[model samples]
Target: MSRRDPYIIRRLNFRKVVVVTLISLLLVILILFAFITESDIPFNLQNRIRVHREHPSLILVDLMPAFVFILLYPMHRIMNRAIGEYEDRVKESQMIVDRNTKFARELSEGEDPEPYPEMIESELGKALRMIQLNIKSGRRKEKEQTWIAEGKDIISKILREYHDPGELSYQILQALNGYIQATQGAFYVFDEVEGRLTNTATYAYNRRKYVTQEFRIGQGLVGQCAYEMDFIHRTEIPDDYVTITSGILGDRKPGSILLVPLITNEALQGVLEFAFINPRIPKLTIQYLLELGEIIARTLLNLKLNLRTRELQEESRQLTEVLRRNEQQLQENAREMQSAQQKLESANIQLENKIVEANHAQSRLHLLLEYASEVISIYDESFRLTWISPSVINILGYTVEEMMGGKDMERIGRNDVVRIRKMLEQLKESPGRIEQLEYSFIRKNGERIFLRTYCRNMLEDSSIGGFVLNTTDITESKQVEKEQRLKSRMQSLSENSLDLIMRLSASGMIHYVNPVVEDYTGIAPGSILNRSCGDVAFQKEFAELMGRILSEMNRRPVKKNLQATLPMLMGEYRAERILSVDAIPEFLDGELETILVVGHDITEAKRIEKEIKVQNRKVQDSITYAERIQSSILPEPAHIRKAFPKSFIYY
Candidate 1:
């Protein structure tokens, strides 16, 4: 249908239809005039027939504008219907935005909300209301759960975050006012330091300020709430009510207050005061604030507990370090004590060994001094005898008991005792020695024996420990030595005289024959020495005489003379000889029983005795001459007769 142009179809209107209809009518009249002028049967009937048949296409075109108007007329009603529906939808969307904005704002403030408007209610309001309710319920559940699970953590945090209860009280007021969409309220915190309630948080319209004034508990509405430990809801405030924060709230001209004490299990920690921007807030709205206030209280308690726990943890760590240091010091002290004990034990062992060695040395010294032949004694610094060796009992002829009792000193000669004391005193001052001095000591048997003493001073620290005495008995030795000298002189005289001197062993062998033996027997000692005296001498009987002499050598008083007659082998003779003999047995050349004999020859005297018969008469005559000399010195017999007439003189 490219043939139809609607723009062209719409351009023709009723005025154009009128103008085109007039021009068509005028044209038909002109065509009819030409047909009638040509003379046809009846002119008037001819016009009517011509009009019905002529211009059928022009009549169809004239009806096109009317058809176009009918068609465009239905489109105008359709356009108006569409415009009205669009306007209604716009109004509904605008209402939804307004209602949702109100819902969001109310929910954020924690207000008890009303339903949305009807316009939005049929659209998105139902869903939004359900979501808001769920949000509120979830928030309440979450708060309760946190209070249970982390209550202590919350209390500790609150105590750390807000130093003063008043500061926290203001936070609660702000929270309440924000939720209610009312900008007026007050908060009272219990000031335990000041022992009163302080108005802390306040809001009036768009303004906020803190009031530091305090009131006694039960002094006003706020105080009364803390004192009673209960909440006060006052919708109509009395004229006489005490006002603590007066000019702070804007919309709360003289609004009524609700005072609630922030109570825990313990006494009141703080109090809260609220004023509605209006005379009173909704009951449900205040209840909502009350529930939130409970959360704040629980959090404050938890904050206190957690702060204490953290402090304890720090303290425990410090204590552990101190304990570790103490343990280390104790261990070091124990080690030092053990080392000291070991050193003491080692020193004790060495001391014991030294004591043993000293005792052994003392025992040996005692034994040696006891067995010595010499008498040994020790004295103390006071000159009192302390100890003497056991040999004193044998050598000094005294018992140990006697010596210990000072009896031995009493037996010493008086002069020797004095000398010993003087020597001891000198040794005490200056220590020295005294060699072999003769001292006499009386033995226990009352024999005064000569003692040869050797003494030395024993000193300790320049003072006399005592004196040591070494004594020997020499009385018998002196007697024996005197006898030996006499024997030697007699032997020398006999050897030079007309006598025979000889020494013989105990077995009768001749040991020595002096020169006199050769002169008498005409035999040299060389021929007679070691030969039996019986064989060398003239008679065997002489050997028996020599044997008898040697046997009696040790006997006392060997001075004896004998007369004998013998014949010599060199000449025939019967001559008489007088012999004076001395014999001694002596130890010679380490052999026992050697005899010394000295015999004098008086043979010439025997011859003179034979020649003179009056030898006995001469001995008698000499006795008469000795008597006559003795009478010369006597008084006369007459004198004796005159002196004693009654007595006869006996001559």
Candidate 2:
């Protein structure tokens, strides 16, 4: 009933009760008057007495029923009004409950749960509370049935074809649309390198548009969800917020959103956000959406982890194949290189013989010096002051007298003189061009000459003539070439060495390591290097192995071929290595005096060995099968017994 209807009924009942009570009293008075007039005995006296004596019971009888009726009417009206109000409230509450239950069931049923609440405050909160209650009540069986079937199909398709995590995430968003109504959404995960959450997947109504966005840990709505580890309500968000959702949703306006936290174990995974086109959606429905979002988050995390594992596995397989191909190529190239090297060596020897013959034919012959090419002299076996060719003035910037001065040794740097002496000695043994070496000589101007010279020793009948020098200034080239060669040689050694070569200082710091360690440990070079190799590469088991191998070899340089398995790599590895440890009192590059470690990588060899084992098993199986067949070709035991009974089967 409307609020005013009960008051109208009560007023009408009160008026009817008053009218009935008056009519009943009038009837009683008339009856008493008629009775007194009909009797006619002392009429005047009796009428006076009767009028004076009123019966209490009769008066009460006339008014009691009307009084009771009037009193009961108001009481009944009050009771009815209260009950009616209560029933109305129950019905309204039931309607809200039903809506919530429907939303959850629909989600379980793979039906689109509407997105009305943007940020928890409005109708969305009520909607979410209802959904929570329904879920708690376990009334989502029907919904879960449909969701399970559809979700299974979706997950199957993702596993079968969507290898890329981004693509799989997109498919996941699409599948979520089957359950929740949303205009846009995004998936994010933490980037370990950058230490921030980055968008890995997105679902927007307009596929043609794009958004460039990022969030700090606690900067925006999504960030709050991640950092606070709780749901962020839209109504709770302040205006003039730093995080403008406009770029994500087309127009630059604040829309209602419910930022739900996605967390697993001890880590905050990410936040899921739903954008609504219509702002009037009830808060309760939005709550329902948040619960659904949690499910999606869990599934996404698991799929992502699985995808990463698969990627690692695939990468390992590809690397192994590449390594195998490279090894084969190296073997073939080594053969071809050997043949080419022999040919080159023979050609060099023949050229040396011809040059020797030409030098012997011309003694003290003056060949006019060309541009930058000159005749020069160094001491013979006695190491005395030698003759200076006239071309020395042009090449060394010194006159012949100064070049041939008795103090020529004093004029050059100790290093330069030592190198020249070395070169002359080398010439006596072999005739070849002297490689460019850093040296300083005194110019005629008395300035130090930092020159890079290429020289060839003058030889006569396998004996040293004076050394012929061709020098040039190379102060800049020396520095540049030294750095270039250092880097080049380091890179080449890292790539070409079959062994795992690492350099360490006395502090046990790993300065450098080859890439071959990954084959044995499955840990990437980037992850392990620069860290303590003893801690990471040689864990408890491998460390023990190293100690044991060192001790068992009786301190002698040893060779070991071993097999081991690491739990992280999920496989066994066979390694063949030669350990030649020698103490260096003064090692190059200031290395530890007691440190000398040499080991080679033999993962491929180990793999081949395993393959050989498998092949051997197959061969054994084949032989057993063949033997069975051969035995089958022979006579039965009973027949053999019968045939050999007399001779006791001696044959």
Candidate 3:
């Protein structure tokens, strides 16, 4: 019945059996001895034996067996107890090994392992411990890889969308804080010129209070991290280290803080600091932070380098333009000198040659102004035009002769004339300094043109002792801006409308959708654009109706209005929505180009209508039932006749 039964025979008690056997043997021997001592012996053998028994050696031999048995039995009992305890320990050790093996198997299969309570001090325990360590290490490594991958995706998205350093820093800090479960964090970028770190962005920071925004290289934990180009993780945070606040719980000190330096190419770019309420942060989290720091640092450096490159390129372009203008001016000066030298050689023809050279110079300047869309004119101190470039004919619809001798003011609006007078006075007071003014001027064709004019006093030159004005037309740009403003107003109105508005091309492809569509269909407008209307309609009948409408649109006249009631899918549940849609066709150049559809959600209205109909039907049924009850209560005409067989008695 029991496992030990196989080894045991008849369930014998060894101690009892040994005692009984020894007693029996001793009794038999004693009986034999008595016989030898008391009975008659053959041939005098018993008499000889009795004589030797009186000696000391024979007496000692008789007592030895009893002493040996007494000592050996007690020793056997003690040894048996020790062996039982050792056997129990061995069984316990074997169980521990089996449990550990099961746990290891579960872990390998990516399942949670059962808890093992037995502690084994054998080789199996040490091996199991090593396996557990390896499993933990592997899990940590997987978590780190996943975290780093997600962090990289976030960082890349930030870099792609934001170019401003402040915006990038803020997004990066917010993302990092969320990933690391930090209650508070800040990003500090190194300012090379100031030799200090400046706080560029912060997460969960109070803006109304004064926060430390600047740090020296070795000032605090943040600064030290940057200086050392390493990270610091502290769990034994002091009470005064950092405070975290919750709206429900109020303020408390953070349990841990981490400071990491964003370093790339052996150079410190910035420092990132985070405070957490958890006292024990996983080492994988720290690894993620370090990897993120390197990526952020490299990305920031690239952004800065790109910005610097753009600035340099812009400066170079400006310098090149300046050089080009200077060279053109030098060429003009050279031509003028050549003309003067020729005039000096022929003084008799000097005045004629001078007039020709002056005309040539003016023509060349006019050609340049025309190519640049500029109008140049010289004005006297009395606001009289002395000279004007012929390009004014193209810019302001005014010929050079019409613009000369202050006649250009006739085309200038009255308000502009007044503004020009004030600008002239200012120009006289600040000679050789340029002033810019933008105003509207009447063109020769009675059209108002917007022009930006640069005015500078040329008082130092004796030949032209007044001001030079260069004007550029800007009417087209002004018109475009006005149109843009009107478009923006229309867009705002469409976006806020309650009814769903959409535009579809002649081919029935969705072209545009307003924001209200998302509210009705629970799908973003952007997700459905360029798709056929039939594809998105929920019901088969609605899809068929849409196909029919698109097919008839080509044959229908412009401005034809069509209406339909169709069911649409609503929300994640795909609930039926009854929509009353109105499609209005828009025509361009006598051809239908697009259809604008406006849909009103009428699902609730339809439900109410159905309920009203059901109530009416119930009311009719009640009336019929009441009539049947009245018929049963009252007698029929034939029954009344039978019952009133004695109708004559009534008469």
Candidate 4:
């Protein structure tokens, strides 16, 4: 219903009032003329005849007002209808202006603008459309300005938090995703050292399910964007292109994908990828994305340079500390040498005055050797111990007095005796060089201990020494090396397994995930750690089922094998996969601790099973149809028997 304008009604009323007033005045004039003609006043006959002849048409004029009055209602109705239509058009034009104003405000506020009204062929509608176009242009300009200001603000924030590249990338990606209403996005930074692109952060994405984290300069869409240093937008995405999953809603096929390269100063720094549910992104939005991409590129470059500067500063600090420590050590060594020189000079001065005191000095040297950790023994040419340090008691479980005259080789292992003899012979042959050998020796307690022995022959010692042996226990170090090798092997096996392996806490939070998850779910392992399984499940039912299973496993604290049909996201599609999961519960002190889950992907088998069921149903339908055809076409047994009765038919 169109609203009537008050102005149009007032104008119509004014026209009616004028027509009535004119009719009333003409009636008055006619009445006055009749009165004058019938008055008693005398008049000339000639004047009366002239006046009568001139006023001949006055009678016709007197009837004209009546005819006008008769047509007044029809004329007023026509004029009113025309005026109402004009008022309706004005109202429509006002509505268009109001709607355009709203759209313009929304644009300036950085909100989604409403679409333009449909075009109308009427003149008023055409004028409204032109007005809307002009308004939209102004709104778009305002939106661009708003976007520019927002981008600048975001870039400033990113710069403030640019100390860590991972954090910076995450913040930038989150901001971009929010601005564009993206379903998912990832940021990949170019690693100059590795010569590849590596995923640094993601928004609404499972990094553990990312199949490929490293890309060459021209590898895929992300790499291609980097190579071209431009943005790539695809609206009609293929089914298996990429998968984006949200909690409980399952996986979704993206309607559009955008890959933008972050390039600054002719250098490719990174790539940003976004998945969107909207197929047709607005032109203004695209322009904003491009401008934001430039800001991100420059920011990334700055982050790299800042990181390099920090690294260099850290290295310089470390080098300075090392040099300072080395200088201190060198000064200490020089002081020790000077003190030793002064002691030697004092000993030379006292040698002539007291030969007995010099002999006592040798005994003090032997006493100092007993305080060392390593066992020191002096042997004669026959390999008999002439003197031994008290450390021999700790290393060989033998007293110094008992080992003083005993053969040093007596406690050596039978297998190592020949090697010991060979080392001793080599020391004797090359007295200028020291000989080192590792061997095992039996202690007094009958325990075998590995020892690394350094032997040096004394050629001109008047104190009657053949060789000085320094032996260090190396048993603990050898054991540590053996354990490290075993651990390395185990870690390699776990990392290379083809099954999806995960470890979860008793509370159902993921503690670890192996690399095989990437092959199945396209998520990276590092991204899922410490996150609840419910947060990453493909469906709500799956999350609930897993929670229940985890609770039961925690209660039972036992190993279990289970089979379930789960919805798994494969690329941009959701597939019902049959998973054969093995849950191994780990316990400490009889209490449940962690659970290890290993799952095998059985989607292909499930697909084959569904196909077989479909085929079997078709076969059953065919068999039923065949039975019906036989029943319809073939004669009844009774009728056949009747027809063949004369011929003596037999069954």
Scored by lDDT, the top model is 3
How would the candidate models be sorted by TM-score, starting from the highest? Answer: 3, 4, 1, 2
Alpha-carbon local distance difference test for all models: 0.62, 0.57, 0.71, 0.70
Of 1 and 4, the candidate ahead on lDDT is 4
Candidate 3 at residue 409, lDDT? Answer: 79
TM-score between candidate 3 and the true structure: 0.34
Query: Which ranking of candidates, highest lDDT first?
Result: 3, 4, 1, 2
lDDT of 4 by residue, 224-301 (tens): 566556677777564544432111112576777778777676677888888878887776666777777777778778
Q: Itemize residue pairs with steric clashes in candidate 3.
A: none
Error of 4 at 218 (Å): 0.9
lDDT by residue for model 2 (1-651), tens: 566765676667667766666776677566666756666744475564664465445456546657766776676667667766776886766666576667667766745567444324437546665666576456466555565556556656655676565676567656654445667777666553343566667777735223446665644556546655556545323344434432254443435655666666535666666565555545545545455545555665677788788899999998788677777688776876798899999989988986775465333233333222443455555566566656767665666687566646777767668877776676667643344455766766676656765555444413335454545666556657644543454465646566655543334444455676665455676776556646675656555644544454334433444444433433476434323332212133232222234464445676788999999999999999998997798777678878887654332
Model 1 alpha-carbon miss at residue 131, Å = 99
> Ten consecutive residues with minimal summed lDDT in candidate 2?
583-592
Q: Which candidate is the best by TM-score?
A: 3
**Model 1, C-alpha of 581: deviation from truth (Å):** 6.3
**If scored against the real structure, what TM-score would every candidate get?**
0.28, 0.27, 0.34, 0.32
Model 1 per-residue lDDT tens digits across residues 1-651: 122333234344434555655665566566656655664545686554564467455355445545655665566556545655665676667767777778778877877678745734554677777777798789887875564445334444544577455565555455456655555667655655355766666765556675555666545566656755656666556444445333344333455666666766645666666665466666555555555556666655555466567689878887677667766688775786798799899989977876775576457545655665567777777788777778776677887778989876798867778888887777677654443477767888887777777666665423225676667677787557635653564456545556677766666677667787765556777898768766765454455566566555545334444434444553675543456566655663344546667776666776687768678888989999988987897778889889988888665
Worst 10 residues of 3 by lDDT: 241-250
Candidate 4: misplaced stretches above 4 Å?
A: 1-132, 205-212, 238-252, 327-651
Error of 2 at 371 (Å): 75
- By summed lDDT, the worst window of 10 consecutive residues in model 1 runs over 1-10
- The count of residue-pair clashes in candidate 4 stands at 11
